[model samples]
Target: MTTYHFVGIKGTGMSPLAQILHDMNYNVQGSDIKQHIFTQQALEERNIAISSFDKENIKADQVIIAGNAFPDEHKEIVRAKELGLPIYRYHHFLGEFVKKFTSVAVTGSHGKTSTTGLLAHVLEAANPTSYLIGDGSGKGMENSEYFVFEACEYRRHFLSYEPSYAIMTNVDFDHPDYFKDVNDVFDAFQSMALQVQKGIIACGDDPYLHQMQAKVPMLFYGMNDNNDFQAGNIQVSPEGTTFDVFVRNSFYETFSIPGFGKHNVLNALAVIALCHYEQVEVSIIQQQLKSFKGVKRRFSEKVVGRQVLIDDYAHHPTEIKATIESAKQKYPDKEVVAIFQPHTFTRTQTFLNEFADSLSQADAVYLCDIFGSARENAGDLRIENLQERIQNSHIISEDTIDCLTGHGNSVLLFMGAGDIQKYQKAYESQLAS
Candidate 1:
């Protein structure tokens, strides 16, 4: 049996890829920092051995998969190189592996995970399907006919994939550390669009995506009437959101998803458009959309006492605004409080004003220290700069628990793509004490 070893397996994308490999009956083991991460839970449940990073874990016979975050000088990577083991980066391996099945790569700035998860769920109901979500969830079947996965645009890594069909949710300016501007980001997506084998289902609402030119057939899905797949007569409630799908002005079907915000409605439309194009039964699509519980950390909610706490991976300004809007829709009568920890110094510096404008949508806001990356210099950017632009905003610390607890009957939204959960965990622990 071929053994597969992973470096930095606890990462959100790495963990899911490891799980998928394990489920496919491969002998898989990995090494990462001992720090606890939510992504490790599924790995542990599968009994896949995870150990602290060590060069001794590398074997000449095993293939090594390295996480993108790790440098070529990493100890395990050095050892693997010494042994001349077959080494592949995460995205490169996924790109090659996905060729085994009819793959659907869901790509965009936001909603990639949710859309991939939804499409996976819907397709699995009809046929054997393998899926990898960015939220650290994956499943594999030996005879899967369809493989659905999230394709991130960061650093142009998604350009590695050549999928059968592609669903692009939207194109937004994000990952400021790498790309120069929105046009730079669009060029990457345009390059990726050309690689799709069958067709592309894109959100027509985004001006950037609207300008996409693909060699394959490109189908547009959005609220706009000009789209190939249009969503109309939308209704949003605390329970969920429902919309009618129209295919080029003809009513197709009415679908509902157990999620809030117009973004989610657009996500489902992308899934519906692709599945319908593939000739999947409409009944299966409707049933799967109704049952999807949503991907982890994308509007994940829990009730503690009279307050609702939502944890979401909304690091970008556009995503932050959608999260705040979702909170308001679900709990219209309660105060919506946003607790955001800006992810990277470059991103924070680049979208400083935009972040302030979006975060101000909440009734109250708490800003935490910017989550710094080892690769970037912090310079002079500070959380204080963002707080100054918002009305009811304050810096959050261990001392802010008292102020947070004062907001009764409120929705507390913990939003970010960094280690913001530590702050949420700290607040939860204080409440317990």
Candidate 2:
């Protein structure tokens, strides 16, 4: 049996890849820091062996898969090199692995995780399917006819994938540490679009994506009439959102998803377009969309007493606005409080004004210190700089729990891509106590 060893296996993307390989019956074992991450639960449930990082873990016959965050000098990587074991970076290996199946790559600035998860759930229900989601979830079946995966654009890593079908959710200026501007981001997507082998499903509502050039046949999906696949007659309630899907001005089916906001409706439209292209039955698509519990950290909600606490991975300004809008749709009569922790210094500096504008959409706002990245140097930027921009906003700290207690019958949205969960978890414990 071939053994696959992963270094830094607890990472969001790495954990899922490890799960997929393990499910495929590969002898998989790896090491990472002993910190208790939510991803570790999935690994433990599968009885996958996980150990503290040690160079001695490297074996001669095992193929090494290294996480992108690790440097070449990482002890296990160094040992793997010394042993002359075959090695691959996470993205490169995923690129090669995806070529074996009829793969669909979901890529964009946001909504990739939810869209990928929804697509995977829908396809797996109707047909044999294997999927890799960015939320530390993956499944691999030996005889799956399709592979659905989230293709991230950060550092242009998604260009490594050559999927048969690609879904471009939207193009926006993000990952400021890597890409210079929106045009730079667009260039990366355009290059990847040309590489799609079969077809492309893109959001026509996005001005940037509407201008993309692709070699494969392109299908547009959105609320716009110009889109080849459009969603009309939308209805959003506390339960979910319902919309009628139209293909070339003809009514196809009315689909509903257990999600809120126009953004999610657009996300469903993209999936609907792809499934329609593949000739999936309308009933199956509708069933799967309604049944999907949603991806972790993307608008996950928990109710405690009269308060509804939402945890979301919405660090970007656009994502923040959408998350707040979704909260309003779900709790129309309740105050929506946003507790935002900016992800990286570079992103905070790049979209400072935009962040303030978006966070203002909430009824109440709280700011947490920016989550610093080792790769970037923080200059003069601070969370206070953002707090000053929004009127009546408060800085989050140890006193946050006491301050939050003032609001009753409100949705407390803890939003960020980093350790903002710590704040949420801390507050939840206080609430319980």
TM-score of each: 0.98, 0.99
Location of the lowest summed lDDT over 10 successive residues in candidate 1: 397-406
Residue-level error in angstroms, candidate 2, position 252: 0.7
- How well is each residue in 156-177 modelled by candidate 2, as lDDT tens digits? 9998999999999999999999
After superposition, the stretches of candidate 1 with alpha carbons farther than 4 Å from their true spots are none
lDDT of 1: 0.92
Candidate 2 stretches with Cα past 4 Å from truth are none
Query: How do the residues 189-223 of candidate 1 rate in per-residue lDDT, one tens digit apiece?
Result: 99999999999999999999999999999999999
The Cα RMSD of model 2 versus the native structure comes to 0.9
lDDT (0 to 1) per candidate? 0.92, 0.92
RMSD of 1: 1.0
